[model samples]
Target: MGTREEIAFDRALGALIGGALGDAMGMPTQLLSPAEIKADYGFVDCFIDPAPEHPVSKGLKAGAVTDDTEQTLLMASVLLQSGDSFDHHAWVNALVAWEKDIKARGGYDLLGPSTKRAIDAINAGTPPEEAGRSGETNGAAMRIAPVGILVPPGEALIARVAESCRATHNTTLAISSAAAVASVISHGIDGADWREAIGFAVAAARAGEKQGHWVPGGTIAARIEWALDMVEGCSIEEGIARVFDRLGTAVISQESVPAAFAVLKLAKGDAWEAAVIAANLGGDTDTIGAIAGSMAGACAGYDRLPQDRIGGLVGIDLDDVRELARALVRARLTDEKARHG
Candidate 1:
């Protein structure tokens, strides 16, 4: 591979591992307020086992990841498995199979509200295009890094994001959030500066908001800009505090997605820093951390992450996505026609 291709490959793998890192780091803290996180874990700088009372993650290990990483990897696998055709049935089947595996392992039920509702809708005979008409949550955006890795920003990325969202997160806010996250990753893989990648993400959000069925919410692009502006010039602690209080850290697409962008800025695009910050930011911490970590990884590549933190991400066997990450970069590098809509 040439220099550019090699770089892309590294960033793609970085996105995968970075995602797992953040997901696992935040697994134990989800649903707590920032104060609660501080009180319980005394600032989550590393992976710690979930509190016994954590509804979904209590039974898992310190470095265990939740549905954010699982769904992202599952989407990546389905994207590759479906080849050029985007087999809808295959996608749904993959989700179903994943859900089953979680159950068999006695893993806590981790499907986000939007995902569960959409799947239920589809199983009840809702049309694919309509099943997720009301899904305006973070579920779609959390699993969208693969699209970013495989497709360039602009119309192609928007179209691919639309396809990725249609069956489970079809609403405007949800699609826009996913596009924003994916665009940042895509631009990072393409060698854009971190701030430049955020610009690309805003543009992608604008484009993506037009694709899915309309839903009432603040414009995702505008929210991202507001988020960055709100935290500009703040120290890391102040930035995290401002984001947690003002921007929110909930599951709504408007809240969590933009909060992630803000986290990326605060961390200066360091995957390890981003994960640390997001893990302590409280509600929906895992997804927020995962998104920021994915973008940071895409911007800087796996080599840039801290060596110590890498050892803690063992619960998710990141080797599973290493080869897949390379294949994605290959698709992007060759201008593969198979990637086209």
Candidate 2:
């Protein structure tokens, strides 16, 4: 690999590993308010199994990651096979295969309601496109960081991958949410300035909104606008507090996506702080943490993450995620060269 290829490979690996580590670390205390988490565990730094007293905590002891990581791995596998192109059929097949695996595992499935519905529709012979026109869940956005890493920057590229997200999450809001997150990842991989990355993300979100997916009553755009406004006016803590106050514990795409972006902005280039703050925001903690972690990981890279903290995850191998990221970086580079050379 060339020097540029090596750097991109390393950055992508850092992002994938950092994302998983952050996901596992926050799994136990997901969705708890800052005060609630403080009162319970006094600061969640490692992968401690959940206790009986804590429902979300109890699930953690089982070493189970919610739909966030599972879908991410699934999406990565699909993208790897597609060779940096958008193949709708392969995407559907991979999701179907994942659903089968989930069924075989037999306990506490990670497939969300919307994803399940889409899978069922596909099983019933519905086209992949129409199968995913369900509610606007954050499931689509949660697993899309890899898409950002693999694809280049362009609305067309973003839209193509965003449509792949629609194979399960078809709502305009959900599609837009996925694009917004992917755009951030693309810019991060390209090493754009943080402010420029944020601007790109905001533009992507607005474009999605323009497609009529952003409903009238939805507060997602408003909240995102508010977050952007607070960029210069508030401390990270204050900004987090504001997001939590304005957008509560609901896990819908409208609530969670904006909140995740808010926390990402607040973290200000610090992955650990960004993740922890997102985790302590009180509801949908894992998803929020995962999303924020993706952004932070992309910006800070894996080398910047603390060693002691990275050592704490339980079930999954962070090394494998890094390997996948490296492979993906190579694939992205090869494709880029083929197209432009």
Candidate 3:
């Protein structure tokens, strides 16, 4: 590969691996309150298995990733196969298959509420597009990295994001949140600076809000803007406290999406710190950490992540994920060339 292409390839790999690292690291603390997290594991600096008392993650080993990485891989595989002609049926099928696989393994970490409800609807004869018309969770946004990587940012791209979300999360806020995350990944892949990437995300989200069917709630765009603004001049601890207390870190897209962005901004593009900070946050830590790690990984590239942390990932091979990232970058380049040439 040429130098520029090689760099892109590395960053893509970094983004995926970094996401996994964050997911695994935060698994033990996923549903804990911030005070509970502090009381139990302290700062959560390393990967630890689910504590016996842990409500959700018990029986899972340290370094094992949860639904976040699994769903992200589902989307990545679909993107690799279909490229710009991505098949919605294929995407939904992959998710359904993944949900089954996770359950068969006796893992309590199954699909999120929106995804579960939508998939049930699809299984019960509802059309895929109508399955999740009211889903407002971060389910779609959490797994949207692949979509952002493969598609250029624009109205069409955001529409495609919303369409993909339709399989599970189709509300205006959900779609906008997913579009924002995807746009950040897209812009970051194309080498936009951290601030520039945030700008792209905010703009794409504003436009995306108008594309999806409306649902009653606060605007994701405004929430994202407010979250970013909240962290501007604060200390890292103070910024995190603000996000934890105010911006929120729950499964709701309105909260998690903006919180993820705010944490990433606070980390200033450092993949490790971003993941660590998100991991320590109360509520939905794994997803928030994964999101931050994904964005930071895209900005900093794979080579920048520490070797020890990469070595600690459970049930995942770094080389395999690196190969997946390479394939994804190649597919994206091919898709871009065909459109712009």
Candidate 4:
């Protein structure tokens, strides 16, 4: 492959694999307070299982991914199977099936509140389009990296993110946040620098926020802007403190999305550093780490991921992730070529 294509391939691999690595790295600390994480394991830098007292990830093994990576891979699978012509009904069905499998397997770290509510609605005979209308959490944004890598940076990409998110997170805030993440990933895969990529992400998020069905919440764009403002001239330590202390790491789209962006800003787009820093940030660590890690990984490419972490991921295989990334790149390239030709 040419240098350009090779770079895209590597970035794509980095986004997905680094995302999973970050997910696993933060598993133990997912529900812990920053103080609790500090008390239990000062500065989480390795894969560790959740503590017995942990609310969400308890009983999970070290390197076991939570819902974030699980849903990401599911989305990737559906995206691959559908090619460019995704069927929204099939996508919703896949989500329902995945949820059933998770419940059947006695998965403790089950779906997030927004996703769970949407799935429950589906189970209760609600139509697909209306099932997820009330979801305003970060669930859609957390698992949206595959969509980012699959689509280019444009209105079309934003629209796709909206469509993909509406089945489980239809709110303007949720769709906008998801679009921002996907746009960033798309820019990163296309070899854009962090600042440029983030710029595109911000713009796309604003545009997407205007398009989705309205729900009551602070807009993701405004929150991200506020987060960026908070870190404008602070030291890294201070920036981190500000993010964790004030920006928050909650499951809500407004909180987590901005928190992820704050960590990314603090880490200066270094995938490994971003992931580790995010994992250590306390609340909703895994999801924040996954989001930040995907962006950082896209910017830095796959080589930035730690070799040891890659080796430790429990159920996820790095090789498989790499192969999937390559396949996505090839398919996207083929589609782009066809469109241009």
RMSD of each: 1.9, 2.8, 1.6, 1.7
Cα lDDT tens digits for candidate 3, 139-220: 8888888777667677777877877787778789999998888888877788776677888888888877976578998999
Task: Measure candidate 4: CA RMSD.
Answer: 1.7
In the range 1-341, model 4's lDDT, one tens digit per residue, is: 45867989999998998788778878888877888888988877777777887777777788888778888988888889886666667777787788778778777637788887887787788876787889998899999998888888888888888878877888889999999899989999999877778887678889888765798888788888898889887776687689988989998999999898888888888777777787788889899989998988887788766777777888776777777888888877887898899
In model 2, how large is the Cα lDDT of residue 227?
61
TM-score of decoy 1: 0.96
**Residue-wise C-alpha lDDT for candidate 2, range 14-125, written one tens digit per residue:** 5665566657656777757778877877766556665566654464553346557767877887788775356677877777777777667553566777887887898899
TM-score of every candidate relative to the true structure:
0.96, 0.88, 0.95, 0.94
**All candidates in order of TM-score, best leading:** 1, 3, 4, 2
**Clash pairs (backbone) in predicted model 3:** 63-314
Give the CA lDDT, 0 to 100, for residue 268 in model 4: 86
- Give the CA lDDT, 0 to 100, for residue 128 in model 1: 76
User: Clashing residue pairs, candidate 1?
Assistant: none
Give a tens-digit lDDT track for model 1, residues 249-320: 999999999999999999888888889899988899999999999998998887877767877775566567
Say which candidate scores most in lDDT.
1
